[model samples]
Target chain A: MSAQRRAQVLLAILAVALIVLPFVSGSYVLSVATLILFFAFTGQAWNVMMGFAGQLSLGHSLYVGLGAYAAAGLFFHYGIGPWAGVWLAIALCVVAGAVIGFLAFRFGISGVYFALLTIAFAEFTRIGFDHITWLGGAAGLFIKVEQRDTWDLLNLRGTPKMFYFVMLALAAGAFAFCTWLLRSRAGYYWQAIREDEDAAQALGINTFRWKMLAVVISAAMTGVAGVFYAFYYNNLFPEQTYHISRSIEIILGPIIGGLGTLFGPILGAAVLTILADSITEIMAAAGIEVPGVKQVFYGLCLLVVIMFLPNGIWPAIARRLGLKDK
Target chain B: MSAVNGSPILEVRELDLYYGDAQALDGVTLAASEGEIVAIVGSNGAGKSSLIRTIAGIETQRRGMVRFRGQDIGGLPSHRVCELGIGQVPEGRQVFPSLTVRENLEMGAMLRRARARLAQTLEEIFELFPRLKERERQPAGTLSGGEQQMLAIGRCLMGQPELVMFDEPSLGLAPTIVQEVFHTIRRLHERGLTIILVEQNVAVSLKLAQSAYVLENGRIAMNGTGAELLADDRVRQAYLGL
Candidate 1:
């Protein structure tokens, strides 16, 4: 078979496997699969800004925390449903993204400076949330969980299997959206800007507008992930949600898989989540209570990937498989 | 209408630029008439590139006006300036490195004016550079310097610009490729592109230009017909080594 056909068949098989996975697995394995899909979705969102548009954002947790709080706050206080609250979350995140994008791009802050600015904004938001006593602040916010035998899709309160399917849908939907985006006009403009801003400008691309668009879209997509996070986890904490470590976790999948490719983030998330979970399980079984062992494993994986696959594992894998990536 | 009857297609008046308290261009003024080749010759750091950058709207002019077809375009963004139909082949062939040659050309036709006839423009570009067509799928970075230059010029032309600016088109190129570049510029002039040619190859630019300006220390030191400046003693002493 041709390489393209082989790739298509491989994709089909993978799709079938994911769809049937929850049925064959226990609750623990199902939860891990859901976690992998969550990371894959968020990683793709972050990839739009840094990988495609060449704008590095080291503090993407700012959006996630903001989205989570905005939706969770409304849902907690006014008794609004999560489905209705998600739009508010998206709007809030887009506004935040616009503020950051305008300040950075309009004033000519780029590269490491841009990355630093994102972190600063996220840190400021985290600190501000800590002081705001109404939304539980640093003490954390909790959602009222009810015991129900039936599925509640509208409220996002359901069995573990239902949450897993929803997350799977989200991951699949994001993948499809990114695929369309990469082939769209904005996608070409983003890649052009990423390659060289000056050259893109000379070719009649409005660099500032396009860069802002990338951030807005990326922020909105990440907002959806935040909604999922808030609903599934049933709680929100400023310390845990908006921390720099959370932002690092969101970006790690894309970095380890591949920066700009479609399937790289998904592969990276699956590999990282499965391995990390397995290690944690093994350590527990052996009665070895090592602190931050998961983090150490992640660091080791990153080191190995950077040393052996500088372009990330996806490109090397694609090359070997004769699949067109890019 | 005014542009058709022998008025300048691009005009710069008393332009000035500075970089952190250092003046790079001082009161530099020049014009390129429609269907004319205007060569700008200067030594290193004489603000030749700065002038082109300012006209292309990459650099903001500190104190002067840049008019395109009598429209004041000073201080506009680079993309807005481009959409107004001014195209540039930048100093070093800055084609999108990882993009395929065809994709690079496609990026140029992204302007609204050029978008409607993208296929036609692509065909014309391929016809203009058969080698580019031959290597359509190859990454631009993998191409040789001369081929990359052709791709740059082709990319610029894909915008369907009424006027095109060339900035040191022959820099870092092999001798034969330099000749090929000059030949392409001459062909483009014949095809009715109002040309602004900036070059260090003094004699050849003057020979190809209808009018030319000599810039020194961010100022217009001399202005005359190409032949007049080519034969002048000061021009010969400073740039030509004659």
Candidate 2:
């Protein structure tokens, strides 16, 4: 078969497997799959800016935290449903992204400095949220989970199975969106800018405007993930949600899977989450209590992946399977 | 003020450029008329590339005016300048290395003027450089130096630009490839496109150009017909060893 045909067959198989997963698996496996999907969605969001546009943002957790707070604060206090509150979350994240993009792109701060600016903004938001007592401040905000027999899909309150499907839908939606973007004019322009900004400008691409658009779109998408995170976990803590470590975890999927490819983030998320979960489970069964074991495992995985497959696991797999990686 | 004279397509007046505290261009003034080739010949660090970059809007001038077809275009971004029909085949043949040759060519036709004629233009370009057609699916990075330079020039042409700036078009190419590049430039001129040619091969550039300027220490040292400059003793001593 041709590479494209082989890739299509593989995609069909993967889709069928994911769709039937919750039917055959128990609740534990369902929760892990949901976590994998959540990371995949967020990772795809972060990938657009860094992978496609070559703007590295190390503080994507800022958008996720902001989106969670905006939606959860409304749902918790004003009794607004997440479906309604998600728009506010998206807007909040877009504004924040614009501010950062403007400050960085307009002022000619790029590369590592731009990344530092993102981290600084996340840190500032985290510290600011810590003092806001109305939303429970640093003590953490809790959403009262009512015992409901029926699955609430609209309000985003559902069992592990429902949440798994929701997350799957999210990842699939992001994949479709990114696929469309990669084939669009903006996608071509973004790749050109990523390859060489000066050359892209010489060819009539408005690098600044397109770069801002990338950040805005990425932030808006990340906000949706935030809304799902708040409702699924039933709690929001600034320290846990906005932490730099959380940002790292979100990006790890894309970096390990494939930076710019459509399926990289999802594959990376699945591999990392499953392996991490399995290792943790094994440790628990052995009755060993280790601090920062998850972080250490992630670091080791990154190192191993970088050493073996410098381009990421997905590209290697794609090459072997005669698939188009990007 | 120039030998090959017509209505000026591009005009640079009293252009001053600075990098940090050091000045790169000082009171540099030149113009290229419609349907003629203008050669800029100077030694390394004489600011030929800087002048081309400034006119292309890649580098902002500290002071002075860059007018295209009698309209002031100073302070406009590079993309805006490109949209207004200024194209540049920048120094070092800066092709998108990872992209396929065809994709790189497609990137060039991004201008509104070029978009409508993309297919026609691609056909013409393939006819002009058959090797590009042969390597259409190959990554540009894998191409030979001559091929990459052709790709760069082809990319600039893809923008459907009326005025294309050639910066060191012959730099680092083999002798035969340099001949091919100059031949392409000559053919491009014959097609009614005005050209701004910068070259390290002073003798050949002057021979091909109608009017020429010798830039020294960021200032125009001599401005005349290519023949006059070629025959001048000072030009021969400084740029040409003859």
Candidate 3:
């Protein structure tokens, strides 16, 4: 079979396996799978800006936090469902992305400077939310538990199985969206801009518009992930949700997988999440109270990956599987 | 003021460009008519590249007007200039290295007008540079310097630009490869395309050009027909080793 055909077959098999997972796995495994899919979705979103457009944003949690706050706040106070509230979350995140994009691109603030700007915005928002009592301030906010024996898909107060399927659907959607984008005209332009900004401009690609589009689209996608985070966890705290560490978690999947490839983020997230979870379980079973063991393990994994597989684990895997030529 | 045909297709009037506090171009004025080959011959740092860059809107000029097809396009951005039918083969053959040769050509035809004729233009470009066609599937960075230059010119042609500017097309190439590049430029000119060529190889550029200007110290030092400048004493003393 052709490389493309082989990839299609592999992806189909993976999808089938994921679909049948809940039938065989217990609740704990289902929840871990959901977490892995969540990271995959957010990592794909982050890849649009960093991997494709070559813009590094270390403060992506700004969008996630804003999105979670928007949906949870609306649902808590106004009795609005998450389905309707997601629009508000998307809007807020897009605006925030636009503001940052405009200021950064217009003034030629790029590279680490642009990353610093994103961090500053997220930090400012976190501090601002801390003092705002209307949204529970720093004390945290919770979604009221309703007595629903049946699945609640609309309000997103569903069972673990329901949430698992929802996350899988979302991961699939994000994957499809990224695949489509990489083949489209905008994708070509993004690749050109990412390779050389000045050359792209000479070829009649408005770099500013394309870069801003990447930021806005990435923010919007991450916003949707934020909505899922709020509804799935049923709680939000400014520190926990908007933290820089949360942004780091979102990016690590893509970085460890492969930045530009479609399957990189998903593979990276799976490897990271499963490994970390197993390590925790192993330590727990041994009754060894090791502090920051997961962090140390992640750091070591990242180091080994960077040292050996510089482009990421997915590209190496793809090459080995004959899914890609190089 | 001397236009080959009627009105000039591209006209630069007293363009002054700067990089920070340092002046890169000072009162450099020139023009190229439709279907004419105009060469800017100069030594290193003579502002030949800067002149074309300002015309292509890659560099902003502090003062003066860049009129393309009779429109004032001085302060416009590079992409806008490209949209207005001006394309540039930048220095160092900046073909998207990671992209395939076909994809690089496709990127050149990104504008609405060029995109409409993409298929026809791609065929034409492949016919002109068959080496590019042979390596269409390979990444552009893998191509040799001569092939890369051909790819760059072919990519610019894919844009269907009325006016194309080449900056140092022969730079860092062997004598035989430079000859091939110049031959390609001649063929392009013979096909009725307006060209603005900037080069340090004065003799070869002047031979290919109809009308040529000598740029020195960010200023136009002299202007004349190719044969006239070739025979001039000042040109022989400064550019050609007499």
The per-candidate TM-score of the B chain, in the order shown, comes to 0.97, 0.98, 0.97
Candidate 2 residue lDDT tens string, A170-263: 9999999999998899899999999888889888888999999999999999999999999989899999889999999999999999898888
For candidate 1 chain A, the 10 contiguous residues with the lowest summed lDDT are A142-151
For model 3 chain B, the run of ten residues with the poorest summed lDDT: B1-10
Arranged by lDDT with the best first, the candidates are 2, 1, 3
CA error at residue B240 for candidate 3, angstroms: 4.3
Over B182-242, each residue of candidate 2 has an lDDT whose tens digit, in order, gives 9999999999999999988999999999999998889999988889999999999888897
Chain A accuracy as TM-score for every candidate:
0.98, 0.98, 0.97
Q: What is each candidate's DockQ, to 2 decimals?
A: 0.79, 0.78, 0.75
Error of 2 at B164 (Å): 0.5
- Model 3 per-residue lDDT tens digits across residues B189-215: 999999999998989998889889999
On the 0 to 100 scale, the lDDT of residue B69 in model 3 is 86
- Count: clashes, candidate 3: 0
- Most DockQ-accurate candidate: 1
Clashing pairs in 1: none
Q: Write the per-residue lDDT of candidate 1 for residues B1-242, one digit (tens) a residue.
A: 11343888888889999987999999988888899999999999999999998888888988999999999999999898999999999889899999999999999999988999999999998998899999999999999999999999999999999999999999999999999999999999999999999999999999999899999999999988789999999999999998
Interface RMSD of 1: 0.9
> Candidate 2: lDDT of A81?
91
Cα deviation of A197, candidate 2, in Å: 1.2
How many clashing residue pairs appear in each of the predictions shown? 0, 0, 0
